[model samples]
Target: MSQKSQNQRPDEQPEEPKADDVADSSGTRAAEPAPAQDEAADEVAPADAATVPTGTDGPVEGPGTADGAPGDRDPAGRDALDRALTDDMNFRTPDEIRSGDATQYPAHEASAAPEDDRPSAEAPPEPDAARDREPETAASLTADRLLDARDRAPVAGWRRWLYRATLGRVNVGDSDAVRLRRLRENSIKTPLTGGTRYVTVLSRKGGVGKTTATTLLGMALAEVREDRVAALDANPDRGTLSDRSPGQTRYTARQLVQNRYLVDSFAKISQYASRQGSRLHVLASDTDPHVAEAFDDADYRAVTDLMGKFYSIVLTDSGTGMVHSVMQGSLEKSDVVVLVSGASVDEARLASETLSWLEAHGRQDLARNAIVVINQSAGLARGVNVDEIEAHFSSRVDSVVRLPYDAHLAEGSEVSLDRLRPATREAVMELASLVVDELRGTR
Candidate 1:
């Protein structure tokens, strides 16, 4: 041994092994720390054994200490190379390295670990309800048992189109407009009660579409309602009401009066009436002026009383003259009165005056509940304001429906209910709907 070695202290050790020799003894290929959770452990590799000398500042490297991970703190003595490699590593406390504190880890790794932001599960807050409610079981069931199912087939519009395009793979509900239209149809189909309902259509002036309004109201009501509807022509003048319909009988209201007692069944009464379609039966008045003039209040009552037995609804097309006996009979029995008017100013004034006349007479309730229809309107012609007419009547009456001038109706020929324009049909239905609501309300 050298002189310096012989004089060494008891704690002092001989020269440490070379890095390669240290690796061979530790069973590691290089004098590098084994892989650990912390990169700091692998960073400080052992220095060359030959370059190190006996030292009292720190302990010497033992069996596995040279290659031991810095993150570990085992019974084996720690490597001596960390002191010599102090200049190579970032500054950190020895206690920090020994305990493997978060500070000892790499800058990016320590920052990459996320801090938990969730509230602790312990001492959870109380539930909003009295106690915890278990989840509902209905959601797990199939949709077929529900009223409006999520998987129901589409009926109209873009959803229906998409469903068809995809061979029914896609499904959705009908559009809002279609749904509302269906609701309207269903509303019109509402059943009537309290025996038969009597509806009368009249106007103070001639050529105001009174007969046409009567036909439309009867047709619209009969189209959806599952009951027979009858339209009676009580015009004092020779009525062209039958000419507006496709089916007409040579028999007039006079037949119903003469055969009143014999008309015990619908088959007998159907002879005096001409059925326009499946449900609307039109009872025409005499075509001759002198003959129609003779058809009076007794005749009107006879016809209505007989038809009322077979028909659930009877619409009276009253004469322009309010003082006509048939008109009086109509007003007397009418559950709902419809006052038809033209869009012109004179026509509107006449309609309003006719309402006033009703109020002055013993028929104030009839006038108050009457539905006013402004018809044959071609929009803003001859300085006429249809909207103003509608508004005025709306305030005085139960409802006002504007029948826009449709080309098919303008021809004044036989009327086809389905051939009317959409706007005209909608107006007609609106009037019918109002009449139905009034009938049901009066009941």
Candidate 2:
């Protein structure tokens, strides 16, 4: 009703007070400002008071308004304005903010704070001058780089040990003469224990050069060493040795066994012995096959014992038959036994069976002395692989001798060492070498 009311026309009569305003009896103004024009214009305005501020301090601040400078609000608004300012100082740009929002709120005065608390934008790089002046040494490099020049670098612990064990340690030094001399002295100093003088050549199956090994071994010792070497044919089917060495003396083993007293004297027995070569004597088997059965254990012992006195090496050619009393006696007195077998699977199998039989008959000690010789007769048979045969025998093979099946040698004719081919002669010589090394302990 005052002058302000008189000026207003009816058409201009103030619109009904907005919902934010209401009359109060005190006369002091009390009204809520209308909501933002944009908010009011849209009917679907948000209900949260935090989102839309009220009252007439221009527009009440929003979250975005916190970026403004301080001292911009009324004293009554200081608390909330100060808090909002603090939040704004802490708030980071999109690029600066970590995704999880883990940063602590900053103090309201952070923007005005000293430079010491904040990090510098640019930092100096490492100095090349300092690095160039530093000392360089092998220790400075990594271990891998240090060994890069080696052909094969050693590994650590078990891996290194395993490698060295698989392929034996490489010896880089030359053999010394002093070491060789010492080895020879050690061998010579060890005396012989007067071992059994008997020698055996055995083949479970025939035609594997067993007879040839026995004969040639005797011939070698006699011809090469000038030692008294005697060859005894114990084959039940006697005459194999004499048949192989034609024109050999006709003195038979049957004659010696017949006269037991003559076995004691080597000079008296020398007449009955047929000289094959220099000192090689043949105590040929009886011309009669049944004579082997006629001789007993005593005859075998007497012949071996008496012969041992005069002969350094006594070679026995055993037949492929089961053990007879005479054969057992001969095997018992033998110092070394030679088992001969061919490369054929059948020969190997039979040899294995024969070895088992010898072991069962308490002749394992003799079996240990057995040496397997692979005879390549006629040169047609495949060269026998010693390793494969050893697998069947369950022991290391001693030697392999290949005899070229010569027509002259096969006939009942006298064949001298010179008559053989060089290769054949070398093979025989190798066998001789093995035998001499084993019996005489000579290389």
Candidate 3:
């Protein structure tokens, strides 16, 4: 058969003949449709019928298949897709959809359900009342409360005066007063845990204020910290650390070393050392220069170990020699180092050289982290650059702080924070703060 005749669809196939029309010579039966009937049947088939398969390997009978039994079609299959594309259902007006009149679109008969069970088209439900309500805000939630916490107390200094002047109210502290009060609180609030922390004040040259720095630093720290703070004159030479504090006892560090076995409590330790007020206690060096030179590393170990039991922090005023045996013991126990220098060129160079020596030695880390304090004992020298000195040391050290000359400090009498000038006090407070911060970090 020709390809055109072979491609005719099964539905358009010609009907078989009756047995009478197919009678043969030996009474055999043959069946065939008339040529006129085959031609007429082919004429009625549509061109799109080319898509329909005619062999045994034809498309399987399934939902929507042309040859699929109507009873076998999936009843749940949706005709919305076909109606949307081929029928006028997509062109329906909103009013027609809301009216629910299916009879208006007879072309959508494929989608007609025996029982209309779709949910009624209605507006969305009103949002739940609770969900629609406004959320509680931070201010609204806190409106009823009367207290608020702070890391530090509020200021009361000038604020009080301002309120009194404007609103005729008193007892309101100003910001400055609050700030100073908080600073005072923070200075003294050192926690009483961990092993004793040691701060050593050292200088390679004498008269550069090593002992002075040690005494004042101890005073500042002791005044603020409630815990026990001590200044130890670790100078192998007769030192003046005790003169900075009230000399209550004739016993020196040597006496403490000899009597270390008996020095167990603060009471016993107080016998050899003198207390400056309540917080700071001072252990004086040997008064006789000849005997002070004999105070070696062994004596240092004995004294500090005994003091460590009673003090939270110990400020050692080391001698004017880095190679001194006492300095060895001081550096060994020191957690922080305060390198003291004068504003003079000679003194500053000496201090820098001392740091270099420390670096050359095994204490490079300590030297790098050490605090450099330039004491302005006398007036500034002519043609001497103090800022350059400060900058130079600052680059080599963790921090460099300048100590301004105060009449009280110049006198070298018993060091007291109140006796010092306001600027002097501020500088010391800053130094104490840096040390406290360092302590916190190490812990």
The candidate that wins on lDDT is 1
lDDT of 1 by residue, 67-95 (tens): 43321233343343444334223443444
Candidate 1 error regions (>4 Å) = 1-159, 276-278, 289-293, 377-380
Model 2 over residues 242-320: C-alpha lDDT tens digits? Answer: 6665355656776776675756677878766777444678777777644536545676677777677777677888776
Q: Write the per-residue lDDT of candidate 3 for residues 1-443, one digit (tens) a residue.
A: 23455676657755465676678887987645437655555556445333322233442243353434321123332243233323434544334545644444553443455435544567567689999886643333321133332322333456545655765434343355345644644644656457899888899889888887887788888887767888888877778888878656588998888888877778888777788464578888878745524789999999899888888999998888788788888888888889989989889999999999988889987887898999985556788888999999978987888899888888877777777887888778778877876775665
**RMSD (CA, angstroms), candidate 2:** 22.4
What TM-score do all the candidates reach, one by one?
A: 0.64, 0.51, 0.66
Candidate 3, residue 206: lDDT = 90
**In candidate 2, which residue pairs clash?**
none
Q: Total clashes, candidate 3? A: 8
For candidate 2, the TM-score is: 0.51
Candidate 2 error regions (>4 Å):
1-196, 276-278, 289-293, 382-387, 390-395, 398-408, 440-443
Better candidate by TM-score, 1 or 2 = 1
Candidate 3 stretches with Cα past 4 Å from truth are: 1-66, 69-181, 184-188, 276-278, 289-293
In terms of TM-score, how similar is model 3 to the real structure? 0.66
Clashing pairs in 3: 155-178, 156-173, 156-174, 157-174, 158-174, 159-174, 160-172, 188-224
Candidates 2 and 3: which is better by TM-score? 3
